[model samples]
Target: MKVGVKDLWAGGILIFLALLGLFINGGLLGIGLESHALGTARRMGPGYMPMLVFWLQLGLGCLVVFNAFSNGPDPLERWTKLDLTTLAISVSSGVILWRVMEAIGLNNNYIQVGAPCFVAMAVLAISPAWRPLGLVLASFAIFGLLLEPLGLILALVGLCVVSALADRDHNPVSVIGMTVSLCIICWFVFIYELDIRVPLWPTIF
Candidate 1:
């Protein structure tokens, strides 16, 4: 039943997801005991957040169901319409990227640098009208080149330039600045505060 402002479908689905999260926390389906809000007792477990989440999802789900039934027909699009062509392209492209990289002898688990290159190349080859192919390729290339010399943060900044070039209206300057600023902030947080290494890839300085 559709009741409230937007949609019961979306609301109900969200509520269901929350309930699922709750179930995982609840240890209902052969999971371990987790923390509950009251005070983290014996059977309850470690983290209390999940119990609260379960109650929230159940409550919201009920509310959503009630609203859905009370509401009239939606004035807007009710459900998401699938884009078959785009979906097909996306799936096929991921497979194509894997195959191409393996063929090129760039077989790494992450395949960080080359994977995006292959994907971009494949997309451009198949869909010439995409128009940002050149920029996309240039961006990844520049990023790889800068990755070692400038460090992860600076290289990311360089890549953002390439990203900006992909779209005419994208402001590269602002993006670069933002990227650098975020990196510094994240670096401080991850390094100083959390004591975590920032680099999953090569750590340049």
Candidate 2:
């Protein structure tokens, strides 16, 4: 079967993600797995999650390639000037943000989060379908900003609420109920079960 641009693009992206995951897992990103304390059960290795994710990505990429060869050609979607502009803006913004964050310091979580959210919102503001993604990014940025001062529960609640807003069909009551339930579950898993040192409630709360 003839390969189409969409297939090529999809395959390339999956392969890229797989490689990036491997790079991260291999400790080429400067944060080695050796730095993390290994639990008695060997479940706490720093590379464990990265390795799993990368392997999954690699598997999916292989599947994509196999499908590309086995299936019929896909129709190519034409990109308009607006699409090109959006792509350019998104890519440039991400690149610039990465460089700036690296030059300054990655320790600044606010900048790390805010820059990408700004880029997403700015680039996709014209598209209604993409507004949900923008909203999710914005919510994550806010979560990162509030994580320290507001504490984990509050930050999580804020994230859930704002992210839920992304879905136009979402009901506020259900959103709130789910958020509270999730917060409780997180508290039990991360705090009570794992005994992580982070605060559950805000200082003022």
Candidate 3:
């Protein structure tokens, strides 16, 4: 009845994330759900789905921990110096660049472009095997960073391109189709139908 180290670590992380989400959802630390109500299941408040998800995650994490004790001997993988360096440098570069730009009151296109570039390059340089993870992280970060300066359409396009690049088997036609479909759907649902205030083009335009 030995504990599987890998499963133990995985389950611990899942439990931690679930607890963090529950704390936020329940307003335990005054982080989130401040104004949102926790209405009944039938009524379905804004916090209802997230609370349910966190509970499910907690249950799944507990099950995984239980299984870890019952499962065979699987050890945890050690993070190399390069792995830690890659993560630290990549994340810090983007966040530091963003903070510097915001502090200087220069929320320009350069900050939006530079941050993700730094992240992608650092990840690729240090750990080429983690290309998909790096690409996905950079893509989402780019989308968030560029949403204000470059607008929704360009941000979505950037997201699609970078994310598609993550998959080695991704086709150009499929990427194009997905990009177009996403743009149209977002435009219709978020801007037109929902009347949300969002920019459609570059701020310069």
Candidate 4:
């Protein structure tokens, strides 16, 4: 039996996520789960469903790992030194640029957000095949940073815009439509239905 590289990476990531979820929910270490009651299946608490889901994910991840080890004739993907160098430079430069901009008083929303995205895209552009990866990474990073300050809708818009850059043949109209649709769905699910206390618009405005 030969190890499958793809399966190994997938299973490893899944297992890590499952373990992270369990750790957070279980309140291990100094992390407190706070009022997350674990009610029965009939009357589920916030923790109940998440705990069950993580357990199931853990089981599935274990099965995937076993299959990875038991599978045959799977070749590993090649990652060149250039890829690692590009990633390192992009991340470090973005961080440095962000701090410098803040210190130099050029830290408006446009500069704060645009600098990182531009650096990621430019650095990864050297490897044209991996441009999508760059866009996705930058999108998520920016979204996380912007969520609290800029709010959910703006963060989603930023995410969609940056990620959409990956598709060269993408239409601007379709992109706008998709962004609007995503914002609506997220507002419905996370803000309205789930009642999460995240702001929809920028807090300052």
How many clashes in each structure?
Answer: 6, 0, 0, 0
Say which candidate scores most in TM-score: 2
List the candidates' TM-scores in order. 0.41, 0.63, 0.60, 0.60
Q: Which lDDT tens digits does candidate 1 get at residues 1-205?
A: 4445455665777677776776666534435344334344223334454666666777787787677667866644432223334335645776777777778887674554455554544344343344365457656766666655466666677677666766767775787687778677856765556555335245534
Candidate 3 accuracy as TM-score: 0.60
- lDDT scores in order: 0.59, 0.70, 0.77, 0.79
* Cα lDDT tens digits for candidate 3, 11-62: 8888999988878787444465344676775465777768888889888999
**lDDT of residue 123 for candidate 3:** 65
lDDT by residue (tens digit), candidate 4, 22-124: 7888733425445477777555577887788888998899998889987855876687888777878877887888888888888776757676766765677
Q: How accurate locally is residue 138 in candidate 4, as Cα lDDT from 0 to 100?
A: 71
Better of 3 and 4 by lDDT: 4
Best by lDDT: 4
For 162-181, candidate 2 gives per-residue lDDT tens digits of 78878889998999899889
RMSD of each: 9.7, 4.8, 5.7, 6.1
Model 1 global lDDT (CA atoms, 0 to 1): 0.59
Winner of 1 and 2 under lDDT: 2
Which residue pairs in model 4 clash with each other?
A: none
* Model 1, C-alpha of 161: deviation from truth (Å): 5.0
Clashes of 3: 0
